[model samples]
Target chain A: MGATFMLGELVGGLRRNLSMAVSVVLVTMISMYLLGLGLLAQRQVDTMKDYWYDRVQVSIFLCVEGSQYAACAGKATTTVQREQLRAQLEQMKPPIKDIFYESQADAFKRFREQFKNSPLADQATERAFADSYRVSLTEAGKYEVVVSTFQGAPGVGRVQDQKQLLDRFFAFMSVVSWGAIALSALMVLCAILLMATTIRQTAFSRRRETGIMRLVGASNGTIQLPFVMETLVSSLLGASLAMGLLWATVRYGVGGYLSKALVDTAFIGVGDVLAVAPWVVGGVTGVAVVTSWFTLRRYLRV
Target chain B: MILFDSVTKTYPKATRPALAEVSLEVERGEFVFIVGTSGSGKSTMLRLAIREERATSGSVLVAGRELRALPDRKVPLLRREIGTVFQDFRLLPGKTVFQNVAFALQVIGKSRSIIRQTVPETLRVVGLDGKEKRYPHELSGGEQQRVAIARAIVNKPAILLADEPTGNLDPATSREIVRLLDRINRSGTTVVMATHDHEIVNEFRKRVIELDEGKLVRDQVGGDYGTTTSAIPVIRLDEAGEPGQAGDPGETGEVR
Candidate 1:
């Protein structure tokens, strides 16, 4: 019966202050939506890191005809020299997982296929490139070992770790993730203060009823339960709305328009969004409940 | 029953006490009138009885509980046992007449079955049975005071304190309110009414305690309103009959 009375008062109080109540809902929804967006961006960055980092390879390009390295001698090292280098590379402790030797002809074929529609494809030839060993590390961070080993070795002109390039790519994304999280936090603070003030005003308007309740032997919890429930109800409405908006944005707005327009890399997938749904819901509900409890504690005493 | 022992209540930053060393007692089921002019500590006395204001010195006992020693948590329980009717008829404007009366029982955690059964019966006692659904603003002054009365007694508290319950009503309506209060008193609820209305005091001829400048000037049993010189002329002429009339002067005027 006590719970029902409190629930009734909560509903009645919300109805009595419709404009303020709507403001609370809107504030909470918009704040949580921004927060959800930030989380989605962070998730996208993590996924991109995983996808690109796994495929990255450190490539050691062999010397060409005019190269000045001592190991190169007068011309590109012979097939026996390349074969010896490959065996030496594999013999290192905690050995590289696998190495693929691409001949100049194979590299040229890949180049041609990649630039099939470009004018450069017509002028490109196998001799224009070099035979290289594309070394796949067991882990991306092991590129340092491969680079140090092959830097001054025979017939090695240049060592390029694709993981470094991927790191630079994701570095930019980390900045964006941080900025979005910061902005969302600021907006959430504003929304929480707004919610607290709105509830305080609601309590002020009904102070007479509260005073009477206090005099009539109602417990402090009994007096405060209605306002707390009011805040929670408004926050829950806001959180659910925010989740719906986030889902729609990720499905249509981000997935369709943004992803297609800027297809520099793979974006967040629908599976990732589904994975983080509980976190988003839990974060929103927790914020709403906690803010309401603290605000009511300060204002509803007496 | 109520007792005050050398009770003194001084507000912050005020030199003098609102109630200064006042001591009084009323037995159970007795109807006592506390009469004083404005600012003579009448309201403070009632507030002390309800434990709304703690005495700065000494103690107050209400219904056998030490009010001054009661903690904030227990104050509400003390109030539940002592019903208070204010001059403003402090009914919640949002609630219906029935809801206002039912609120007292609701606060005490009475079952819904008991609320439904007792509210109408109590309203009938105050002659507001059929007007249950009307809001306070919809009722006349007299009707509102009656609703306040019904709310006060719904819990069947040990004591009923009315701080000018008829302050807003006309003379005839005021008389009716006093009659209702008297009826409640006869039914065994101790009643302490504070009023400045001299006519009602003399007419009812209940025990009256008078105050002046925060001091108890007179306390008399079966006290008339004319105990003090300034109060004599304020009594109704028809009720007081001939001038300088003494009590129980046999055949002072014709029966007709």
Candidate 2:
């Protein structure tokens, strides 16, 4: 009897306050959608980092004939200097996992292959290319060790970590992701405040009913249960809508557009959204229940 | 059935006490009237009886239990055995007459079968048998008060505390309400009514407890409107709207 009566009250309350309930749904949906997007963005950054870091290498470019670098001193690298650099790198085997030497001939061949369709390929010669040692690190992030050791050494014009440039891009992505999460936090706060206000207004309008219920010996739990359930149902609706929005974004927006446009980089998929679904729904429901309970306690007084 | 032992009630931030060490008791099945002017602590006494407010220096006992010692959770159980009515006829405006009465039972977790049986029966006793579908706004003032009475007594409470149940009705309607309350009281439920209606007091001739300036000035069995003066004189509309003579006990010691 209690369950059925409570269900009836829940439905009736929602119906009577349809516009308010819809507003709750919409606000909660927007907030939770942004929150989900933030979570997915964080995951996407992690995936991209894993994909790119495994392949990153530090390139030590050797001085070529007539090079302008101060280390080159406008002289070509000698066999002794080249041999000394290779021996030092070989001694640092713990940090340097593998080394491959690309001669000027090889460098020019690869450069032409890369820009074969461009007119610039016709102007480049083997003399224009620099002989380089590509050093793969045991740990991709330890590029600093190699750069600090070999920079401006004899026969070396420059030491560049491929991961450094990638790090700046990744840092920017991290900022964007955290900014989205922060904005989502603000939206969730707004959702809570709006729900509280809706509950307050409902309580005020039904003050007479609550007072009568109190007089008739209704327990606080009985009076407050309907209110909490009302908020829970509306918020759950919003949460489901948010989950749908998130799923669609992952399925079409990321998979269909971003994956096709940036084929080399991996993006978050529907499975990642499914992983974050429980936390988002659970969090929103918990907040809605607690907010309504506190609002009813302060306002309804039954 | 009800006991107030030296109940002294002083509201917060007030210059004077609302009820100053007043003591009173009404036995089982007694019909008692608590008569006083505005702010004479009549409502305060009722509120104390219902555990809405605690006595500052004394205790109140209802249905053989000390209300001061009652926990907040158990207060609802205590209130279940005692029904209350007010001057404003506090009915749920959105509910129909039947739903308003049934709401009292629903909140207490009564079964649907029990509610279906009890609501109509109680409504019949309140003389609202056919008007079950009418809302509070659609009903007359007297009818609305009847709905409130029906809601109060629907659970078959042991005591009924009415704080001026007939205050908003006409003289004829007020007498009818008082008669209905008298009928309910005769059915073995203790009735404690606080009112300023001299005509009902003089006609019904019940036990009267009059409070003057928060002091229990008179407690008389079969008391009249009293020979004492009041801040707001009771207008006797039943006597062709002419103000009745104050300070006259007319007749006493008879429960007619």
Candidate 3:
């Protein structure tokens, strides 16, 4: 019966202060939405990094006809020297996943396809390209080992890792994620302060009722339970709204644009969003509950 | 029952005491009137009884609990046994008359069955059985006070304290309120009324304890309003005679 009474008081109090209650819900929703966006962006960055890094290869370009290999005693890297390099690479089987030899003609053909729409496609020739061996690693971190080993090889002019070419993209994403996180933190702080003031005003408006409750032998917990429950209700409502918004963004917005833009790589799968949705819900709800509890404690003393 | 021994209350930053070395006793089921002009310690005495203010130097025992030594957590429990009605009525403006009365039982964690049975009965006792849906603002001053009385007595408390309960009502309404308090007293609830309304005091003729400059000046049994002549002899005897005579007068006058 006491619990029913308290629940009734909480509902009745919310009804009495409907505008402030709505404001609290809206504030929490916006704050959590921004936070969710930041988290989703970070997840996207991780997914992209995993997808692209797995396919990155280190390429070692062959020395030219008049280069150091031609002047050496081996002279133009005989079959013996080629076999020696191949054996050395084969020995690194655990770290070097696979090695593919791209002759000068194959390199020229790839360059023509890459710039097919540009004027540079007409000027590219098979003899102008370098014969290179592409090395795929089991992990991105092992790229440096392959690059260093091929640097002073008898027939190698230069070794380049494709992972380095993607540095600018990851740097840009890092800046965006940091900005989002900072803005989300500021907004969450505002939401907490707003929630505190709303609860305080609600309690003040009902001071007469609370005073009577105090005089009539109501426990401090009993008096405070209603206000705390009210805050929880507001927070839960806001979190639910934010979750819905996030789900919609992931399903409609990102699925339509981002997935198509990065067709070859996985861009935030629905399963990943579902896996992290509860955490977002729990995080927003926890923040709302804690902020409301502290605020009400100051004003209601319960 | 209530007992005070050498109770003294001094406010911070004030040289004079609000209540100075005062001692009094009220027996069970007794109706006593505490009377004094404004600032004469009438409200302070009532505050002490309600545990709102602690005495500086003395002990107060209410229903076998030492109030002066009681912790803050126990103060609310002590209040549960004592019902307080202020001049302001203090009804929650948002609640209906029914809810206002039901709140008393709700606060003590009473069962729904008890609340359903007791709230309407208490309201009926206060003569507001059919007006349960009205808010306090909609009720007249007399009706509001009746609602306040219903709330105070709904818990079946041991003591009832009313601080100028009729201060906002007309004279006729004030008499009606006094009658309602007397009716509650008849039902065996001890009532302590602090009022300066001489007409109500004279008509009721209950025990009146008057305070002057934080001192207990007169304690008369069957005391009438504006009749200080009978109190003078008792005071003179209390000052000049033996200490035993002081205690005798309280009993003798009370008996008469």
Candidate 4:
């Protein structure tokens, strides 16, 4: 019976202050959207790292004629020198997981295919490229060992680990992910303050009823439930709206454009969005309900 | 039934106590008036009875429960047994008279059938039978008080505490309100009214408990509203200060 009364009052409170209720809902929606966005961005960063990091290789470029590199000042890579380099890599302690030798012709063919649309492709020739051995390691961090053992070796121009090329980009992405998470946290704080203010206004507006409720022996819980429920309802509505927006973004924004646009690498699918939707619903609703409970405690003295 | 045993309520940083060493009791089904000036602690007496404040010293017992000993959670349960009507008529402006009266029952978790039957009957008793559909603003001052009375009595409380129920009404309406209270009293509920209305006090001739500067100067059966002629010699300090807004009575250690 008390539950019914409170339910009635909750509906009544929402009706009495429609504008404030809408404000709570809107603020909650925006905050929850930001929260979901933060999670999605972190997931995207992890996706990119996994996709790119797993394929990183240590490329050992062999010395070639006319090479200005100091390591190549001795002699151009002979067939015996190339064969000896391969033998040394095969005997590495960790053992190269995979290794492939690319001749200058193979390198030029790949470069032409990569830069097919660029005019730089027409200016490149087979001799313009360098013969190199691409080494795939069991652990990418072992590139330093490969670099020390092979640097300045006979017919070796330079050992370039793919990890270095990707590190700065990954680090920048991490900073962006953290920034997003921090911003989401700040937005949630603002939403809480807005919820608290909205509830306080509703409580203050109906204080006469509350004072009488207190006077006539209505329990504190009875008085507070209505106000708390008002906030919860608004927050729930906001969270639900946020999830819908996220679903739409996943369907059209990510699945429609991002995944297709970044065809060369990997992109998060709708499955990732589906996986995160629950937290958006559960997390924001939890925040709303808990904050509402606390906010009501301060205002519902009656 | 109510009992105040050696209860002295003093506010912090005040020159004098609100109620000084006062002890009084009322039997079941008694109508009593606690009359005093603005700072006479009439409001404080009602606040104490409702357990809004713990007594600074001594105890206030209402309906067989000592307020000081009552746990915080149980205070609401105690209030359920008591009805209170205030000077402002504290009606929910947004609600109709019916909703206002039904609210008391709803808060206590009363059944829908019981609320439906009791609310209308209570409203009828206060001469507000046809005004149930009207909002508080749609009703007159007297009608609003009647709605407040209906809300108070719908729960069928043992004691009805009226703290200046007529303070906002004109004389004619005040008399009408007093008559409604009288009618309620005839129904066997103990009505404790605190008022400064001289005419109603003289006319009703109920038991009057007068407080002059927090001291119970008089407690007599069928007593009239007394003037300064009945006032006892007590220190007058902060005559303009509000006793109702005083500090909590629980802090006995604060008194020096």
Candidate 5:
């Protein structure tokens, strides 16, 4: 019964300080939403790294006409040169895992697909690109060995390892993730200030009520509980709404938009949504509760 | 119900103690008036009795417990047994009279069913039977004091401490409020009123504890409202002394 009375007080208090309460809710929601986005972005980078890092290959481009390398000999590479290169890769201690030969037609087709919307797409043709041998090593570290052995031996125009490119890509994305986190940290500080001000106002406006409660022999905890619960309930409302909206955004916005837009990329799924919900709701609610309780402890004496 | 054994309370920066070696004992179910001018330690005495401020360099015993040794957390429990009504009739503005009266029970963790049953009855006893829904501003000074009184007694505390309860009321309203307190005292609840009103003290014959500069100058049963440094031609001072000194005299205005 006493619990019910205190609940009534919480509800009444929320209604009485509706504007301040709404400010707390909105601030908490926005900040926590950003926090959730940061976490999700970090998770996305990790998954993308795991997926892409293993499949990355080093492409050994064969010499074409007018290639610069002395091994090219100012003419296209012959089939015998290609055969010798294949034989050398197969003889390694841990054999190279897979190899795919991309004809000039294949390279030009891939280039067009990759730069589908670029202005250069209409300007490229088959002869402008070189035919390449895509070689996957058992370990990506073996690229150094391949580059050393085959650099100027024969018909090798360039030895480019995809791992170098992939590392730079992931590094840029990690920076983006950290930037999101830093932005969210700033927003969280804003959220804390908003909640503290709201609680101070509530305590000040209800100064008479709390004073009377104190005179009537109420415990300090009893007097403080309603105000704490008021902030708690409202922030929880906002955080859960943020979580719900975050889930929808992840499910429909990121998944739907990025999946069809980039087919080779592995997008986060509904399971990731569930994995990240608790941190958003729990973290935001915890901050709001603590801020409110601390404000009341300082500003409102029962 | 209350005993102050040489209690002295000095504020943090003050030169002299607000109360200095003041000793007084009020038994259960007695009406004792603590009469003094402003800053004469009347309110300080009440605050100490309620354990609002700790007594410095002395012991205060209330409801059979030493207040100076009492833990801060249990001070609320001690306060729960003592009802305090102040001069301003400190009713919460947004709450109704019933809520104000029921607030005491709620503080003590009483159930809603019990508060509903007790508040209306207590308000009716204070002659506010049908005005339970009115806010404090809607009530007169006498009515507000009645509500404050109702709030004070709703818990059926062993003692009711009133600090200038009638200070804001007119003379006639003061008498009515005093009569209500008399009725409460007649029902065996100890009422300690701290006031400067000489009329109520002269009109109603009870034990009056008059303090001058934090010192107990007079403790008299059937005592008059002594003027500053002079005794008045009112009720004679009965040498009731303490409870043990008076030999457990049952009530006031009896042997006199």
Candidate 6:
């Protein structure tokens, strides 16, 4: 009798507030979806950083004749300075995993090949280019030691770490991820408030039943179980909708479209969606139960 | 079986007490009437009996259990043995009469078979057997009160506390309700009623306990409406609506 009566109360409550329950589902779905995306974006940025940072090469541009850099001093690098720089780099082995030298003609050839479609390739000369050494570090993150050692040395114009450029891109990605997470938090607050209002209204409308229940010796738990179950049913629906939408987004949106468009970058797949699905649903259920419990405690008071 | 040992109750932000140093007792199987005008603390006395309100100084005992020592968690257990009815009927509007009465047992965790058997029998006892499927709004005022009464007595509570059960009914309907109460009382359930109807008080001539300004002024055996109290004018029963005209079909079944 208790179970059937409780079921009756739950079903009747949801039917009475069908539109409000739908609103709760929609709001919870959107918030959980955004939260899932934020988590996946963070993972995507981490994967990309690991992939590109492994191959980042430090470029040490050697001075050419007529070069305007103060270190270059309008003098072309002699064989001695060139050989000395190479020896210095070779001695720094272990940290310096590999090194390659490009001559003036090689630099000019590569420049022309890279800009073949540009008009500047037609007017460029070998003297306008500079020879350089492309150094690959075993630990790409430790490029600072190599850069400090090479800068201001004779015949070297500049030492540029490729990691700096990648830093800016990853920073922007982090901002996007964190910003989505923050917005998801705001929407979650809205969902909680909406659910509280829904429970409060339902409790108020059924106060007569509750009062009679109290007079008839119904315990507080018995009076509140139906209300809490009402919120839980709707929130579970919303959570399931959220998980389904997230799976579809990762399966089709990221795996199908994004992976094909950006062929080289690794994006989050459906597996990551599965990983975050439990957290999203668990979090939403927890909030719904707590909010309903509190609202009923204040309003029903059985 | 109810006892009030100098019980005093002062509500928050009130100038005077609702019940002040008043004491009374009703033995088992007795019909007791708590009478006075409005603000006589009769409702407060009932609330204290049900442990809905705590006494400010003294203690209240119902069914031989001191209510002050009862924890809030155990209040429901105390209430299950004491059925209560009010003027408003307090029926769940959406539920049918059977559901309304069955709800009392359902809340206390009665089984389905028990509910199925007990509900119809209790409805028959309240003279509402055929109207089991009717909702509250579909019934007349007297029938609605009957539903409330059925719900209250369905659990076979030892004590029945009625706070103005017939206040909203006409003279004829009120007499029928009082007759029902008297019949239930004859079946060995103690009835404690609070009312302003002088005719019922005088006609039934039960033990009347009158309260004046939160103080017990009169306690009489087989008493009528006395002269000191300012009572509502008695409405005489017409010939067509005499007391015996309302047939008693419920006497065959014992409520307990």
| TM-score of each predicted structure versus truth | 0.83, 0.88, 0.85, 0.89, 0.89, 0.87
Ten-residue segment with the worst summed lDDT in candidate 4 chain B?
B232-241
Best DockQ among the predictions, by candidate number: 2
Clashing pairs in 6: none
Q: What is the fnat of model 5 with respect to the true interface contacts?
A: 0.46
Candidate 6 C-alpha lDDT tens digits along B25-116 = 99999999998767879899999999888999898999988999998888888888899999888988888999999989998889999999
**Model 1 TM-score, 2 decimals:** 0.83
Among incorrect, acceptable, medium and high, the docking class of model 1 is: acceptable
- Expressed as tens digits, the lDDT of each residue in A48-162 for candidate 1 is 8877777788898887776555556648866786888899778854547778898878999999988888899999877778889998877888889889989878668778899
Candidate 2 vs candidate 6: which has greater lDDT? 2
Per-model DockQ: 0.37, 0.59, 0.43, 0.54, 0.40, 0.56
Pitting candidate 3 against candidate 4, the one with the higher TM-score is: 4
> In candidate 2, which residue ranges exceed 4 Å CA deviation?
A78-129, A141-154, B229-256
Order the numbered candidates by TM-score, best leading: 4, 5, 2, 6, 3, 1
Number of the predicted model whose lDDT against the real structure is largest: 2
Off by over 4 Å in 1: A2-4, A65-81, A92-95, A102-131, A254-298, B224-256
| Docking verdict class for candidate 2 | medium
What ranking of all candidate models by DockQ puts the best one first? 2, 6, 4, 3, 5, 1
Q: Give each prediction's root-mean-square deviation over alpha carbons.
A: 5.8, 4.1, 7.4, 6.8, 6.7, 5.9
DockQ of 3: 0.43
* Best model number under TM-score: 4
lDDT of 5 by residue, A62-152 (tens): 9887766566777888889989988887776364688888987889998999998999999987777787888888887778887788777
Candidate 5: the clashing residue pairs are none
* lDDT ranking, best first: 2, 6, 4, 5, 3, 1
In candidate 3, what are the lDDT values of residues A245-273, reduced to their tens digit?
88888888888887786567678856666
Q: How well is each residue in A1-302 modelled by candidate 6, as lDDT tens digits?
A: 36777787788889988999899888988998888889888988988888888877888888988986678888888889889999999999868888999887998999998788889999998888788898988897789988999999988987889899989999999999999999999999999999999988888888887888788888888888888888888888888888898889888988889899777787877888888888888998899999998888788863
Per-residue lDDT of model 1, residues B58-82, tens digit only: 8999988998788877777787778
Candidate 5, superposed: residue stretches over 4 Å from native:
A69-78, A91-95, A123-128, A137-154, B229-256
Give the better candidate number (3 or 5) by lDDT.
5
Quantify all predictions' global Cα lDDT against the true fold: 0.80, 0.88, 0.80, 0.84, 0.82, 0.86
Task: Give one digit per residue, the lDDT tens place, for model 4 in A200-282.
Answer: 88878888878887888888877787777788888889988887888788789988888887677676767887788888878
DockQ of 1: 0.37
| Ten-residue stretch with the least lDDT total in model 2 chain B | B247-256
